[model samples]
Target: MSVQNRTPSWPGEQLCNSCFYTAMRTHGVCPRCGHDGVLPGRANRTDPKPVCLTCASIPEDYRCRTCAAEGQIYRGGRCARCALRDDLTALIVDGAADPATMSTIVEILCGVERPESILTWKRSPKVRSLLSSLSSGEIPLSHDGLDAVSQRTQEVSHLRSLFEHHGLLPHRDEYLARFESWLTAKLDTIAQPAIRAPVEQFATWHHLRRLRGNSTPGHASERSMLSAKQQVTASDRDDQIPHLAARHPPSHRS
Candidate 1:
């Protein structure tokens, strides 16, 4: 397939001029899948080098290489054996089954599959479990634990309506741009060092939450920390996301 998401993106404005190109050119080498794994000279995740295409596309690769590769089929790094181990660990974290028994289960899963893609992820234990779960209703899409959450159709319609109500662009692309512009304006209000919080929000949240002994929050827990020690209305959150991010700026650990 063509390079679906191999193009690079801006990690932050701090990368002025040549520094931007340099990071991409240098960091393109993916340590996991290694030289054969990355799309050399392609950019994504602000790294100009050959990179693990998926994480960078999920925009997920920006974290520590090890963590980002966890449970994932590293598109452009590592070998089959290590990727299997990573997927096994990820499945355990996602709670596919008990970690003690997962290796055997994954072995079974892998044994039944025939290779169908160059990436070899079609035979991944993680993929097998996810597919089997979906087929058998062992885990519904809405159920908890490591599911790939997607925006529902209603949610999309709601966003479109909101865009219309705001007299903003109604097209998805235009609406997205408008929303990003608004978010950028909000982030710009923050003082130095954390203005890029919007771009790095997921990684930042996970890092901070892990510090509080909360490693992985479910979708609900993630979207909002529902049961706050003190009640803060939605309005309060709207006003505070940027300011709060500034005081305790999160880092790009990878």
Candidate 2:
């Protein structure tokens, strides 16, 4: 009865987004339940020719105008994927960056499990900011470029992980990168080279090297990587010396 929070599934009825998606995902007779179909708004459950909402549609307007595919229409009579691709192309090609150079990003985002999800994510201000920088060439399309962004750590990390996952960027240990960056900043605060060098050596050799050795290439878990950072941080604070010494014997000491 309440269509305010629902989607138009039939002429006079509206379904929630999820239900609308499910209802519109297929048309014609449903293979799973052998239910005969009817026009989207012309049948009822009690009718002699009952309509299966799961496989019903408006024959004249239920398809994507661009691709002629069935499913939930996004805008311009295009499906969500088509619309997402168009929007991404527009956003990503908004600057000096060549359209050809942004094809991969567009393709990757379009190929997500649900194009609708990317469309939703694109609405975030932070996401738009990152994309704007990328489009304008302020941020190079490289790990180093993402690395140089000292602000928006969470957003950068998320986008970097997405890029790495999609093979758009070379795969590397994300946590390891964070630790190395943390170590650099941590060392810069120590004016005395004597103190800084040993701390760096201890962190790199004692914790980082071992973390790398134990890592499964680009597949290191966040917990394991964070644990390594915690170890390095603990070493810096000298809060747990015995543990550090136990791990770093004289023969293998930093």
Candidate 3:
């Protein structure tokens, strides 16, 4: 989580060195100084209990104001986890145009094992933009609707997974669907009718046909779809099309 704006983890919490060690340190009523705070070390060799850091000649206080929990203070004396929950809840309620539509996201985000990690993700510009689109109904809360927002592929895929996991969206072959959309857009980019026509025919009759045939009841494997897409994309290239024509040249027989 950023000091300015807490967000996602690549794999774990992005805590600073101090905060990490401090969080792991013991905190309780000090036996020596009788002060309720972070425990430092024994006052003497024979001491039976731990003492406050100050009594042991070390001094630092990291306590939550609201919960009295000992940890890294996030904001207004609250711990990072607590602050994360509050922030996420506020964002969901305030940003969502329709609270009912966003209920699943809110529930999942709030109940994460590490709110700090999610907070880090929320701080991302792409994530914020996606959330804005979702909140304003710019992107409909459906699989096909999400398919239309194609640019942010990674973020969209993550959101799709979350929605599917929570039963908000029905599971489908996301890779196949993405390839179909990509093919349409890719074909549209070809201005030459000759090139476009041949490319479209090849994509539809060759790659897509085989892919559809191979797909089982559940979603097709990502590897299979990726291979098909690569072949179709390769065929769309100017040089590759000439080769395609050479291999499958039109026959004129008597």
Using TM-score, give the best candidate's number: 2
Candidate lDDT scores, in order, read 0.38, 0.67, 0.68
* Model 1, global lDDT: 0.38
What digit string (tens of lDDT, one per residue) describes model 1 on residues 72-186? Answer: 2233443233445455446443554344344444454333322123125434554555545633445443322122322333333332333334433222333222223344454
Each candidate's clash count: 16, 0, 6
TM-score of structure candidate 3: 0.62
**lDDT accuracy of residue 127 in candidate 2:** 85
In model 2, how large is the Cα lDDT of residue 130? 86
| Model 2 Cα lDDT, one tens digit per residue, 1-254 | 11121365465556577765555544566444565442233355454343454544434355677777655667877878889888888888755466666777888888887888888888889888888788888999898898887533777877777788887788887666767677778778877654455566677786778777776648756786677667666665545454555554445644
Model 2, residue 238: displacement in angstroms?
7.9
Q: Each model's TM-score?
A: 0.19, 0.74, 0.62
* Deviation in Å, model 3, residue 42 alpha carbon: 9.6
Return the lDDT, model 1, position 198: 36
Superior candidate under TM-score, 1 versus 3: 3
Superposed by TM-score, candidate 1 places the C-alpha of residue 253 at a distance from the truth, in angstroms, of 70
The runs of at least 3 residues in candidate 2 whose Cα sits more than 4 Å from the true structure, single-residue gaps closed, are 1-6, 9-18, 26-60, 94-96, 150-154, 221-224, 236-254
